[model samples]
Target: MSTTYHAAAVVGCRIPKSKIFLTEKVRECEHNIPESRIKDDEFCAKCGKPLWVTLHKTIPEYNRDMNTLCTFRVFDIEWEDFITVAGPGAVSEVANDCEKPSQLIHLPASDVRKRMERGLEKIGLWDDNEFGIWAILWGS
Candidate 1:
């Protein structure tokens, strides 16, 4: 008996769909910030280096249906400002608490990744590795 060989062609690489969103009108949450509490005794999570009391406010860009969308302010303070730490969940919870009309939208993880990719593309590094992209965002 004779044998026959078959081959399959690859079409595209598999990657998570980018769903990140951007808003140009990001507002800083007016939540009262306590006095400088960060002390030299504090250690960073990754480097374990001493951290100083500091806080900053920024407004990232986003796009949504203006008619159906609502604006909200988020305060992203230094790691020391948080007690339990700030994750996606924590950010959403805080946003909900201080949202307009007491309503806030929680951004999905996939969307977050997409938004990040979009940001990278803006800087001409859309094809970079995940680690590099993340470093850019974290550093910013």
Candidate 2:
């Protein structure tokens, strides 16, 4: 028997996704944000570092789709270019062809965890026990 190998470059994020509902009041600072972009908090999952926030929203697979919330991590790789050798269940690109988020606001793990954890729990993705899980895993 012989072993096969696969290699690729991908940006991974279990990245919290939230929909800004029209019915919800927009923050004064966020009012200028366009519908084509998502303004989110981006922090280092480990070491409590804030990286950035918000990103360009990709062309939606469905037009008029209102709600936008995701529960799992997405591997953003160019699938169209790597599908032949890539493994199954892995992505070639972000869910909606989304781009890198802006790096304006910075927050640490301490500040981001509780908020992300709560949101995940509400969506049934993470359990109460998984709070602060990010602080311990991964390294700089």
List candidate 2 segments past 4 Å from native: 1-102, 127-140
Model 1, runs deviating above 4 Å: 1-90, 95-105, 124-140
Q: TM-score for each prediction? A: 0.21, 0.24
What does candidate 1 score in Cα RMSD to the true structure? 20.6
Question: Candidate 2's error at 115, in angstroms?
Answer: 0.3
Model 2 over residues 1-140: C-alpha lDDT tens digits? 64333322322223323322123322333233344443453333343444443454532321224322343233222322211111112222311223543332244544445554554456454434433322111111
The prediction achieving the highest lDDT against the true structure is 2
Model 2: residue 10 alpha-carbon error in angstroms: 12
RMSD values for the candidates in order, in angstroms, are 20.6, 20.7
TM-score of 1: 0.21
Q: Which predicted model would earn the best TM-score?
A: 2
lDDT of each: 0.28, 0.32
Candidate 1 lDDT (Cα, 0 to 1): 0.28
Relative to the true structure, candidate 2 reaches a TM of: 0.24
lDDT tens readout by residue for model 1, 1-140? 64333221111111122222222432233333343533223544445544443433221332223311012122222342211111122132212223333122255545544554554456343442331111001112
